[model samples]
Target: MPFFTVIIPLYNKEKYISNAIKSILNQTFTDFEVLIVNDCSTDNSIKIATEFESEKIRIIHHEKNKGLAATRNTGIKNAKANYVAFLDADDLWKPHFLEKIFNLIQNFSEARIFGTNYEEIWDETVKMPHNNSDSLPKDFVGYLNFFKINIKQGIYNHGSVCIHKEVFEKAGYYNENIQLSQDLDFNIRANYHFKLAYDASVQMSYFMQTDNQLTRSSIVNKTIPNYDAYEEWAKSNPDLKKYIDFERYVLGKRLKKNNDSRWKDMIAPIEAKNLNWKQNVLLKLPSSALNLVDKIKLLLLKVGVKPSTY
Candidate 1:
């Protein structure tokens, strides 16, 4: 059997599917199978993915469109390898992705979850700068208990991770109920039971600002559900309880960009001491003023200023 089962949830990513599959096929570490789970795409995605002729490639087509969460679960169920890695159809990985993951597994044999740092592609021409100095110690290898890693550096993206199949047995699979932030929810749940092993080197790419992508959709529609997901996770996890107030504080700022009043109640539980002077000032602004700031931030991004620390 292959050492790793790489799962790609395909939808309408025909333009990028070939590159995504090519990235994996070119991996320095070749002992892996590429599983493409097509979610009933109405586009050329299936045809494009099928054209890639490789003995290591397997395609699973869904009879009906079952969103990302269910599609991922299906991939997990069909995974034959001990380790499972996820790749979004639009993202690309450096050639060393599997090599580094294999190295991490060998070094941290006891850890079940492993991830690599990633860069973000903002648009056609812009790319996020890679800075590894801010990551955990370079020489250190092992588990950073989920709570600490999450509190310090946010959870690793699924596209940049590889998890032992048994990890899902202990923590459970992605929640199919939520439409947004399912990735965050799954990571939080997994972290609750196991520490995530991380490789500081950058290896994966996140393509943002694409049309119809879940993240860049209507802010109000997406942001509200993400906050609700955070709440649901916080209810069962006391370790995450301490971060809820702070999470709410951040979520509130995001919601204000859409002139959303929902953040007002969300921020109530946060202590005044938790926020800094700037945060306090921003929180006091009217919705109109906050949205103006949001517009300015978007304008800056459009003008080629990198506002995000990828």
Candidate 2:
């Protein structure tokens, strides 16, 4: 049984950390080490983690709060296993998570990274039969370059990902410069050299809450898939250039980044609650008196305020 390093990059997620750690401990395949990177959490998350007192559990704390990407990089550096896996503090994986993935990787050792389906839990809703299938759509490689289908269609989730340690080292660690879309950039960078795979058997749960998570304010901050990173990935993807429409999309994002005009260039994910116009205006919304206008607009819109299209 190959050992796996389960890395969790945490930041003040006291309310959720115990549950996240417990989920991994409960896994059917227990041959794993849990590395919790504490990015200067103000909450009692560190205390709770320390109380575990398990040799298998290691905690690395930063004096100052570094963001998610940097924290994960820290965990990666500390990892001591052939395989590296990641779990966000807010998500949960099934008991068979590691067992199933291990079997798949044992069969397909050539694949550098693998991802599985996740049950997206939000607003009292649970999307079941989450794991779709293993085969990437025949044209998936094209989408892999710049996310025309995979990201937009929710074909995979990052929470259920596992990759080789050497792959992480060879491809370079996650981009610390990226605030919002570091995952996208890292995956794109990894894809350049690694053979990616999807296993529908492994299951995880993504609890979508209206808290400090990246999804909540992605549009306002443009971080989920950072427009800047998006532009960089799009322009550099040779495969995307082959498809005329995708080529245009890549060029558009590239232009947006070049001008630093993400306000006009980046489009929020369709599933995001924040509307296009709202995100556009709120990006530049000042924290002082200027926010009152946006607050009022949000309130009025919720109360059925509408006007003819300008």
Model 2 agreement with the true structure over 1-310: per-residue lDDT tens digits: 3389999988887888889999999999989999999999888988888877478988998888879889998988888888889998878899988886787677776787876656766432434433232345422221133243342324556678888887887888887776765776676667667776666543788875323221233234344344343444446663432222222233333334334455344433222222234433434443343334434534443444421110
Point out where model 1 deviates above 4 Å. 130-141, 151-155, 210-215, 219-239, 259-262, 271-283, 302-304, 308-310
Question: What's model 2's lDDT at 97?
Answer: 88
In model 1, state the lDDT of residue 21.
Answer: 94
- Model 1 TM: 0.84
Clashes of each: 0, 1
Question: Which one is best on TM-score?
Answer: 1
How many backbone clashes can be found in candidate 2? 1
After superposition, candidate 2 runs with Cα above 4 Å error: 128-151, 210-215, 218-260, 263-310
Top lDDT hit: 1
